[model samples]
Target: MERRPAPSRGTAVRATRQGDAVSAALAETDAFTSAQDLHARLRAQGAAVGLTTVYRHLQVLADRGEVDMIRRDDGETVYRRCASDDHHHHLVCRSCGRTVEIAGPEIEAWTAKVANAEGFVDVVHTVEIYGTCTICAARPAT
Candidate 1:
């Protein structure tokens, strides 16, 4: 497969077959997945896309806020298609990798209050909460 140079940050990434394939593969799963994993899945589905291409597409999507990424405890970044374009937080299941998007009005207010108290300007933030879900917690002792 021919390779294209990686798109620069904030560059407008036009749609292509490979990029569409990557996004389609991501939409098939609700779990956040690694680039290698997504590449494998694309191959399994007979999509002619490479791992590097997967990474690049994911990076572009993430830059556009079209995807959500999380760094696990081990430091691997995983990507998932965004459910909402609006600002929100994620509650991730540590055991199953399930994610739920949520808004925190109180947290937003608190962030504003704290930042204002310090006279901070142009504040931006992200919040992610990780824990085992009820199903994962209910399984019999392994």
Candidate 2:
């Protein structure tokens, strides 16, 4: 099992029941899920969390780096509990919202080289590759 760092002080200090439920839901999945999907799942499980509350909790998690947020090809945002604290990129399935975490030493080197060339310091970046998965690609076109 992977170990996650404890939340810093002043952020997520008190985990409300709703927040706990939301976190539990997120912990159950590795795929990227939208707020609406999470809300529906919680409702199905008899959790008394509203959609707005789910969105709020997800935002808090993202802000604290506990979860990763990425925009889909359709421009909808999705959230997933981060698997690691280390820097990584994601390959996302546009159809099913599945995600694969990847590390690229070459990409990191390139980013640093570009930053230095542009006279930029303290650079940060996000990379998300979106495409159809095998299942989605194999299906007949709609």
Candidate 3:
């Protein structure tokens, strides 16, 4: 078993088969996926994992900043494997769910400036841009 150091605040996550299964399933997809959908897929594959476990583990991973999370317009939350460890945003294809991780230095500077001007500290932010990707744009509309 490969061991990693504990995260900040003295919290440790023990490795488990179900957690490994969730990570593996997530890594298999390039698109963001709902936890319920991922749970169903794992059950279909005979992963022997429960929905609650999936949710719990995903929250842990998200809190650790090991995954990217976004909320759809209809309020559905989704998760995807992070492509880069550095601070970045996401460009998502609305029709196809394809996602690209990107960095926006200008946005970062703007946010910092705004926050600091208001005397805010410890500011955190997330930005996700959704639009049709090239392939989706090329397809004929139904």
Candidate 4:
């Protein structure tokens, strides 16, 4: 097994702050965020944290399964804390960078149906839908 690096003093500080910030941030917004974006936004929102600290904290949270880092088609990894204890999917707005949470039993049923029909067993699915959001659509062209 690979060994993990020892946590530095800064890392420890960030870890504590990140936990608090992540909780507060999630409570305040419905949008998904990447480390870079979160760093910028948090700073703008007066968090007084650095970019490196944000990235490190994000990695730690992701490793612990406390947050999900989703890599978009453009290669940016966005993160969102899991809000529910059950399985769910997301609808992402490409234009406004918004995300919607969705959950239903019908999705589970359909996944079982399709997987069995295709002769596959023990399958899992994660669905993400992307489209323009209302805010983006209503905005004037640049």
How close is every model to the real structure, measured as TM-score?
Answer: 0.88, 0.85, 0.88, 0.71
Candidate number that wins on lDDT, 3 or 4: 3
Per-residue lDDT over 1-142 for candidate 4, one digit per residue giving the tens place of the 0 to 100 score: 3333324332333326545675466556567787777777788888877887778667766676566667899898888887875788888898766888789678889999999999998797787878888888899999
Residue 50, candidate 3: alpha-carbon lDDT: 94
Residue pairs in collision within model 4: none
Candidate 4 local lDDT, residue 29: 57
How well does candidate 1 score on lDDT at residue 100?
85
| Model 2 lDDT tens row, 1-142 | 3333335434433567888899999989888999999999999999999999999888878878889998876788989997889999988887887788989788899999999999999999999888888988999998
42-105 per-residue lDDT for model 3 (tens digits) = 9999999999999977887887778888899989999999889999999999998999988999
C-alpha lDDT values of all predictions: 0.86, 0.86, 0.90, 0.73
Best by lDDT: 3
Quote model 4's TM-score: 0.71
Which wins on TM-score, candidate 2 or candidate 4? Answer: 2
- Give Cα distance to truth, residue 134, candidate 4, Å: 2.9
